[model samples]
Target: QLGRCRSVKEFEKLNRIGEGTYGIVYRARDTLTDETVALKKVRMDNEKDGMPISSLREITLLLQLRHPNIVELKEVVVGNHLESIFLVMGYCEQDLASLLENMQTPFSEAQVKCIILQVLKGLQYLHENYVIHRDLKVSNLLMTDKGCVKIADFGLARTYGMPPKPMTPKVVTLWYRAPELLLGMTTQTTSIDMWAMGCILAELQPHKPLLPGTSEIHQIDLIVQLLGTPNENIWPGFSKLPLVSQYTLRKQPY
Candidate 1:
């Protein structure tokens, strides 16, 4: 299967669409099938190693994922040299971040519900398969012209088994990060993604980010201000989290 991978020359790059932390994506056309696709060229400039671990993880996960709500990885293609590689993914017309930035009006209640439902469905599938999408945010959610929503960007995703292994607490974007993550909980679960989902659902209504904090300290402060400080009564063992003693939380009973 590795030897049969197609060459990047088979596709015609229409234009550059976007760039992610791991790669640069292009809107391209398959010359043979005349089908439009998203070509993501893996960034290997800084890597002395064969392939980046993030890209390898993404390729491994995407190849096994077969849900409509998840972005599809059609195939892996290559460039002139052995080091040059590209991922052929299903093309999306727009991402929520861009749409939110450019829209003149906010999404209607019904529309917001529809988008959230799709995302929830996708998250359900991921969780069922024991995959945790560590980085779930508006920018990672893509939409097709037909209004189909796809969860994209899997660089930080990981598959968890029983007892869930401890992971880095710094996986998610600060604005959408869950309180547990901010408090330095190493054992993560689907709750982190759900927390981000809540942020996305809230943002769609006002067409703005719910907690747009500039820094981690400010992010935690914003969350505390909105929902009040977490206590043992509400959040059992909240005081025992790894980083709980790092900051002095205000006493607010909201």
Candidate 2:
């Protein structure tokens, strides 16, 4: 992943990709090998509270992960002082987000299957290692020129051997979030990833999101409408959700 040791000033910036809450990603090229790479520079020093915890989590987790499906964190370049941290990573051709958006035609079933199987394999490897990728949205899936899928952004990811609570709602993206998580459960499970996989799988048919919800509540409603609402008996500790007891159900009331 870390190609040549680029001096912070060595990489020439091609252009800005997107401005995220934590940092700005740029497509940069190494002066030595002329190899293009993605540079993620954290805005830690300028913040009032200090370095964002999310950035720290990303750095910590990515450093430990060494899977072919998972994004590789090449090196951490210490800037003039400790304020600026530059993460070097392999150059991915595009993310699933960009691919789906730009594709004027629908993706073939085989193409979708091939892409998702790679994602699942990567996810399976992560789960087997006891690492949970809290964020498993299509945007996080990156592709290589060889059509390899590498899961990026381990900012929300964590290592756990079963949580003390139920499922974690705070982990995944809203649209792809799991029912157990949406119910405000905090127990982390491989099922959460599977749920996101379900969303991803559905998205592949037309290269669009399957259940795109505007809010968490709406997302839960869509799930109930599809799979039906879960009960404390079937789901176990269903009433324990912070928001669950508030509403009465018309269907599958248990």
- Residue-wise lDDT of candidate 2 within 1-254, one digit each (tens)? 12443456777879887544367788888787898988888877557775688888788888777888888887766455556667778878888888889988988889988998899889988888787887888888899999999998776777777434444467788889887777666777777888888998898777778778898777877777777768766777777777787666548443
Top lDDT hit: 1
Report the alpha-carbon TM-score of model 2 versus the true structure: 0.88
The residue pairs found clashing in candidate 1 are: none
Candidate 1 residue spans exceeding 4 A from truth: none
- Candidate 1 lDDT, 68-89, residue by residue in tens: 9999999999999878899999
In model 2, the clashing pairs are 166-187, 167-185, 167-186, 167-187
The number of clashing residue pairs in model 1 is 0
Q: How many clashing pairs does model 2 include?
A: 4
Clashes of each: 0, 4
